[model samples]
Target: MKKLLFFFLLMPILIWSQSNFDKAEKLFQAKKYQEAQPLFEEVLKSKPLDIKTMDYLGEIEAHQKSWVKAAEYFKKLKELRPTTADYFYKYGGCLAMRAVEVNRLKALGMVGEMKESFEKAIILDPKHIPARWALIEIYLQLPGILGGSESKAISYSNQLAQLSSVDGYLSRGRIDVYFERYTLAEKNYIKAHEIGKSKITFQKLYNLYLNKLKDPKKARELKQKFES
Candidate 1:
């Protein structure tokens, strides 16, 4: 009878821990990594073997620029559960971060390492949209000697464009603007605005391209749109 009573007493505590984890997850999704991290750590201290806690820790560290630490956590997570795609994806991200940090070397070793990480992520989870998007970004930014491939970048960007996410369209538009592809850039910016009117899209259209396009009338219209 005493054991049963003790079990019931402890049940609420266990439930509260889970609720805290849930709140942390919501904060993470809302891009509040700093706020979510301590809660995740608290959950870990309570439930040491909880895979979700490690995953959240890894993601939070990644956001916080603690890539080496993030890598360690993700590595542990993969060791505990090798089949999870997100595990591999986030672990790969940690490696990529390390490569970025180690970029100022005599040899281009970091770049190769970064590519390997992204490659493994894509292999483990083909539908991992962030990995695909990141690969495109790398291709665009890297020099030809360091394995940049504009054609590959375009292909990846096109794949991203099919997604419902506005960021994908915005990415394509940014690439266009880089190479002076004005009309294409404008189309992509318009599409992104239609999906979700972020400050970036409005600023690009109203402040830059709209004026250049000699459509001050439409530019004013969009300025009002952004203000509202």
Candidate 2:
């Protein structure tokens, strides 16, 4: 009777456990994210070495704004398979997001971590465009005194240029802005604007005019033009 009771007690748990993935996926598809998290987590606990599970869990954490946990999961993924660019890319991207919600020095430290992860991603897969863009953003934001230079940034950008035209022009403008060369930056940004019609292009121009170029008039013009 004890064995019979034990088997019955375990049946519900086993059935639910077996069906957890399907349940979680259904919830995820329905955007019932909170409902999905625990089941996916339970799956992870049992299958600790499953990289695909880790990737989905990391993505779910990202969607839930759990940046630190997401980064941790991605790091675990990298540890399991260090040569995968996707893992490093996700790790760097998560760290970058977490950095935004913290204090200055902490954010700076996260940026350093982000850069290292991005470099690793590039080393693993030189053609990973998203990883390339992450590196581009780092080189642009980091200070020259702290191992950040426009020249180095520009070189990386140039390598990216060969892959896509829009990316190329955008990168060139970024390099121009870094060196306080407003005219060149402006032209490249405008060209990017023409090709992509993306708000990012003009946004870059606005920052250059306001911060680097020290010309509020041009910045104001861009703001007015772009905002419309």
Q: Rate the local accuracy (lDDT) of all candidates.
A: 0.78, 0.83
TM-scores for all predictions: 0.68, 0.73
Clash number for each model: 0, 0
RMSD of each: 4.9, 5.0
How displaced is residue 171 in candidate 2, in Å?
Answer: 2.5
**lDDT value, residue 64 of candidate 2:** 86
> Per-residue alpha-carbon lDDT of model 2 for 1-228, expressed as tens digits?
999999999888667665887788888889888888899889767667767668878889999889999999999999999999999999999999998899978888777778889889988987877787778777778877767766777777778788777788988887777677879988998888878777777777777778877899988977887778
lDDT (tens digit, per residue) of candidate 1 on 64-119: 89988998898898778876666766776777667766645622565565566566
